[model samples]
Target: LWGIPLLHTEGDERTDVILGKFLKARDFKVSQALAMLKNCVLWRKSFKADEILDEELGADFDGMAFMFGEDKEGHPVCYNVFGVLQDKDLYSKVFGDDAARFLRWRVQLQEKGVKMLKLEPSTPNALLQVIDLKNAPWPAKKVRSVLLKAISLLQDNYPELVIKNVFINVPWYYSAVFSLLSPFLTQHQKNKFVVTRLGKSTEALFKLISPEKVPIQYGGLGRAGDDEFSGADAPVTELPIKAGEKKTVELAVTTGGSSITWDLVVVGSEVSYGAEFQPDQEGGYTTIIEKTKKISAQLEEPIRNSFKASEPGKVVLSIDNSLSKKKKSVVYRHIVKAA
Candidate 1:
């Protein structure tokens, strides 16, 4: 139902392993599994998890969360800035009481991690999520409410997908909040999670990821320039367009083989999206990707794509809304790196 092809669990030769997650979520009961599976699939369908891509859900929360690099086991490492999320203020602005929208964004991030793992077949079936709670402002009740929805979604549909959950720079009084969360976490999950303050010691983080792969914000060589995740709280671009109009967003790629990543969402029904590479050499333009779809008015979600340039040049992202007869606003998140 998610449109993802069936994937194996490595050493486990079970073809039904994907189905197993739903079954396990229902306690291995056949009828219960069916019911739960249907509901989960329906929920995802209505929420349009597949469409969120990596686009910014709101102007204020653009880079509050993102994927930096892989851990020692090659699992994708995701960082969540719990500090930037003022539950009432942020969530309200982004989701406006639509719980599914909030949950959908989180699920899409996990799916992006899974997609990354497919690049390294030898890697295990899991990802690492680091949430920093240094200066979170939400009250316990608001925090717990979001956690409840997260737990239900991750625990049920994406079982065993999160191998590590590192909570960093937790404030001294954070224990009170964690106590409420502990009941929902299984012993295995608890064992895989850690909460720590750097305090001149980043040993735990380095243990999971090589320093080179870690972001500079975390005392590592990884680069996240001007990103909100970089502790910089950088601003993201927002595009407004009319029907039959097109917009081009470009990023400079000075290093050969540097990667350019982009995320964009059409707030209305449908639009045309494409990506092209303009080489520094007097070479002609290359059409790396061309995709167009007309999703129902429900929401087209976000479209994400990336390509590694062979030489220094510019990567261009263009979206055409010529097919529609209405004005639309597109929020975009862009990242560049010489990977």
Candidate 2:
């Protein structure tokens, strides 16, 4: 049980004097009250004896500590800290001086599917009471060397098991050393040693496991959204067609700035087509096929067919420059049928 003193604006002790006696009469232990005072000291570092009790204690007490007081701004504040006691002998067996024993128990816990382990700096004494726990020497320069020896011994004896060291709160200087040891670590080791502090920079360090890998598509020159396809050489243009038309037999050429001559071509095995047009500066030229005249009905029939009826066919559309004779063209291919 725990207790703390409450205070009012006046800081008067008599404000709850009657209530204090009723609380004490209810069998609240004095030692418990003192423990609450100790907790207040730990949190705030200072408190008046009278104000401490008035601001903190309550009638129903549990085995915990409490705090009492106001901040420098006079805002009321109070809180409680609870403690749990565990068995002592259990501690020694789990985290004792023998690193081998600790490693074994850690493996057992992981096999049971534990996700995380938490240790409190404040609760070390309680933990030590159950297990023969001991801290590794401080300022140790060769911690990895020692850990590697332990890992080798485990692997040699338990052929089916591998151990990995996972360090939490790693200071910045040791990150490079961790990278050096990564290649030697096994699959189980990699799974166990997750660096929690990677944050935004994690993408640069971590390698993708098989299940997480994905394939990427490659795009070529003069593609949409490409920066290199800018300027007069590749002017913005659109190709318009009817909803059901499979292809457009005619081609239109438009250019900005200086005069230029361009070549339009359709490259395919069954049918190949080409045309040349010269447009003056800021001018354009249109080449109409007059579908009824230029293209034969048999060829135009296939071009007008929908993808549903065409099981398999390939067609490439290209446009280039003829003035400089450069192959600065946009090429696109479409497969009408699944291969």
Across 122-240, the per-residue lDDT of candidate 2 in tens digits comes to 21110000010012122134445544554454332222221222232334555665666677665544564544331211121112111011000101111224332234343322232
**Stretches of candidate 1 above 4 Å error?**
1-17, 20-38, 54-59, 86-100, 119-122, 198-201, 225-339
Candidate 2, residue 107: Cα displacement in angstroms equals 3.8
Give the alpha-carbon lDDT of every model. Answer: 0.65, 0.28
Query: How many angstroms is residue 95 displaced in model 2 relative to the true structure, after the best TM-score fit?
Result: 11
Best candidate (score: TM-score): 1
What are the per-residue Cα lDDT tens digits for candidate 1 across 1-339?
A: 334444553444332545665565556888987777777677667766667675565545545688988888778898888666666677564445755566666777777776765422344757788887766765457556777777777776666567778988777777777787788876766887788864422445766886546665554445555242253322345577798887787777899878777655544446666677888787556656644445322332345567888788887777777777877655566667656
**Cand. 2 TM to true fold:** 0.19
- What lDDT score is found at residue 286 in candidate 2? 33
In model 1, the worst 10-residue window by lDDT is 293-302
The C-alpha TM-scores of every prediction are 0.55, 0.19
